[model samples]
Target chain A: MSPRDPSPGAVGLGRRRFLKTATAAGISMALAPLRSAYGQAGAPGDAINVALVGLGAQGRVLMDAMLKIPGVRFVAVCDIWPYARTYGQRYLKKNGFEVRAYENHQDMLEKERDVHAVIVASPDFWHAPITNDCLRAGHHVYCEKMMSNTIEGARSMVRTMKETGKLLQIGHQRRSNPRYLVARNRLLGEAHLLGRITAVNGQWNRAVSADLGWPNHTAMTPELLQRYGFADMHQFRNWRWFKKYGGGPLSDLGAHQIDIFNWFLDTTPSTVIGSGGRDYYEGHEWLDNAMVIYEYRLPDGMARAFYQVQTTTSAGGGYFEQFMGTEGTLRMSENPKYTTINREAAAPPWDPWVSRHFLAPQKAPAKSDDDSSGGSEKVDARETAELAGYYLPVILTKAIHQPHLENFFNAVRGKGALNCPADEAFKSEMAVFKAIEAVESRSLVTCQPSDFTA
Target chain B: MTESTNTQSDCGPTLGVLLLRAWLGVRAVLTGIEKFSDTRTLQVPLLDAAGKPDSSGAVVEVTQKFYSLHSYHAIPDSMKDKFAQEPLLPSLLTTSYYAVLGWALIALGIAVLLGLWTRASLFLMGLLYVSLTVGLILIKQDAGVAWLAIHVALIAVALSLCRHNRFTLTRS
Candidate 1:
């Protein structure tokens, strides 16, 4: 018999007790820093033994980050196809790292019992099951984002993370990047720099590209391919476009920006409405282009945010999130090149902010002498302010992945909390999947507090 | 608006400090460019004892300019003997390393010249100069002390002027 999707019920209850448990876990770890926190076997030189499940694209990126970091050792790698495993193993071996390779994750997990953590980089559908099995086996996990393809499966991850009390870091690496931390914690949280953020806009636009490809390798037997639910190499390579395996571009790409929208706002969106279809890719199960709008009810009043994901062309711009407030607007992107903070012309001057080093000041572009509006048109005293655009400082300079990987490894070693924990990531899943549902239902979907109730 | 002026004023680095920033930034640019393109500047003080801008002076790489006082020919036989004994003679001179350092100098120089993230730019540049001093010390090079002293003084001036970074492209 073929394996079916695991039951979400296997992991029970997502009560509010996580905070208390997490706090207790923190205190206990603080008490004993040298030892492992999750009652697992420790590694020599304080290095953590990490096993990876999928050696796909992101999996390789994580492996590269691991190679750079001092403490992470790749003990085992598992992949259904031979290419990923062979490439990863050869690359690591060349780098003087010795690791065992496996075709089945269960075998990898069983053989590498000493592994302190597991990084699940499989397809969306396998996220929950693999994470669930790892958590049950007492290994900490750093699963990539989109906790699972379905909300139910996503919820199961949250439940298992809570029940097992093991650290489950979802790969929203942005949360761990110091730039985002400073923007969220220092600028928005402490300084309230973008005073009373009233609206937000986000988008991730990707230029059209060729469908995913596989290296020229001897094909696996038909049964071997079917065992993993792939009918052919094309489906295996391009699984993200299939409905049965993954959410379309919205969940694939929009989840990250949508997660930021939810995060920077500090509230779960109350309503979502979106629309799109595979207008370009006729056979694609997921929408090649999607636009989702979310309404967030903030403490000050109701706030709204809009998000769009397009695969046709990146003509407009790349991915970024902009939070607009009465005083100014803060725009951030992973690329330091695009990040900027623009001030409202009429709003209170940002001198104090600049003085406090809360913001880096940029000069408004010099107006051309041919400018029409510089006239001394003594307009009304109250309405004299005009908006001017100036850029904010860009401080990020290092590779982006290293910081988050450090966070996860450090969290495992009792240093700090996971920057993007499962509970936090599931919040984004609700927003993203519901937005996908919104596109299908073609109506405004109201989200209740219970939607995030786990 | 007081906001506009104060915001501008916040970036008000002093004239002396700005000059220092520009000098260091331009030095980094030149140094970075000489790494791959000109590289002939390392022999200026040797071929032209007046330290005039000969092709050698125009092409000195960061390490060669800061160390190995002689052009490879100018080094005395005694020091050349020490060079043979020493292991790993400053590996930061790689092509990729120079390229990145050049781009960084250009970026930081532009940032300081514009008063954009002035503190970080000045702090990093100062830090880099100090690090170069340390690297020179590690390699037992008596050279670079004068440039280090000037850079150290500039770093101090940068700190003093950083709090008031006005008359530049960016602030704070």
Candidate 2:
């Protein structure tokens, strides 16, 4: 067979089958409002002490978000890069926090006993190990998603979290965003906007971009690169493109959106079929574009969701997900600009929904197909029915990452439940890995219940 | 000879109407899909289910910036704050107007081609064009004002002719 053909025969028979052992699916949020927790980290006025591991791009973003949360305080920062280490310390000191700096995470863990929690923003390869170490050291961990590059690594984190009894919240930040909480919990879960959701579709199309560059002032020595399994500075900075260090673009990008598929459906996929190629970017280990379909068996019938991420062009639009059902479709992006609930023609009148606070009572769409009124001509009802879609407001004004971090800190203090906890995050990991497998294999991969179990 | 003569005479307009219907039908369907698929209307930085925009939405952001960049160039220096916001309210209003207009054109063309309620389709096409003309004239922009008037005139003529058409899905 040609190397171009992608077909996964079995999990243990080949590397594709080996992926079957990987962990995680679904984002079953414990529906409870958070109470202020974590006064124990400091006095009533003092912020809870937190340390950060992996001073990469996501690490920096998380640090900024952590600073914004009222109760959390950055106490230590660690990275393999000497410049990054000092940069973290300097940045924190500039912000009035006396942060301890460490070139190694183990050193940070051993030294910073006062830290109440740790945020693991390491590359995909290191997520499990670093998060596990932090949990072992008695600090709650908020690790970034796609739990690890490997399902085994992801599963190990879940096992470690379970063993330690520490709060291990995975960084699927959408779980924490209030607008999504309203969309998912209030609208879908409570009100059932998209009644009996039968299908889902989503895409994340990014414009062409150059290879990522590292910000460290000094390049890593060949020995250091060898130690970290990187070929050079480029590989270190762009670890996401590598097979060993990252889950490529599929696990990196698709993990976020597919988790929503699992979130809205409240079920792990039974099968995933995908097709993709590295057509756009050359010399990358990961595919540049991947399209995957996941089959989720609902109680009444089978529902399907299609997810695609293309790095070559942003021709059509930005990333958004739509849940379609018998009644209506609820589509939302991060911005309020695209969030809306569109009713189907056969769906019930939406005005009653307004009283339920699910929809904003706007004009009942003056341009309906029903009445030619006194003198004007009437349009067809079906076409005008599409116009009756309602837009939601920009209700959540806080930056996106803040709420998840807040939830993690709150969970650490025993005040709130973890939204994207290890068990839930792992389902997404399994689903993501399965999709990546299907794309590479060029075959329909059936997911057994065993596939989701670690 | 009589049957053959009658058949030849009837075939001409029937084929013409069918051909015309296909042309208008395909054009309307494709344009409707285009409107539904337009990048600006799609809205994003495709966020995570958790509502994070890490994946997409840069196109909208860049376009918004471009709008602001142009407005900053054209507007008075005294109103720099208002101008800096870019894609001002007028532009937003114009976008909404065009979105609705795209849908109506699509609906009008499809209904007319399919002969689905001829009177309503022709009237709607005319109403849409007239509304668009008024909106464009209100904006006072030279860019597409002339085209809007042409559309209005063409729709007006089509509406008048539609009054006498015998071929339709539903007869008056």
lDDT of each: 0.74, 0.70
Q: Which number leads on lDDT?
A: 1
Candidate 2: tens digits of C-alpha lDDT, residues B44-84: 34233454642212212211112221122222233334323
DockQ of 1: 0.02
**C-alpha lDDT of residue A151 in model 1:** 90
lDDT over C-alpha atoms for residue A153 of model 2 = 85
**Residue A273 of model 1, lDDT score:** 92
In model 1, the Cα lDDT at residue B110 comes to 74
DockQ of each: 0.02, 0.02
Query: Model 2: runs farther than 4 Å from truth?
Result: A1-46, A214-217, A361-387, B1-172
Most TM-score-accurate candidate:
1
lDDT of residue B123 for candidate 1: 86
- Listing candidates in order, what is each one's chain A TM-score? 0.90, 0.85
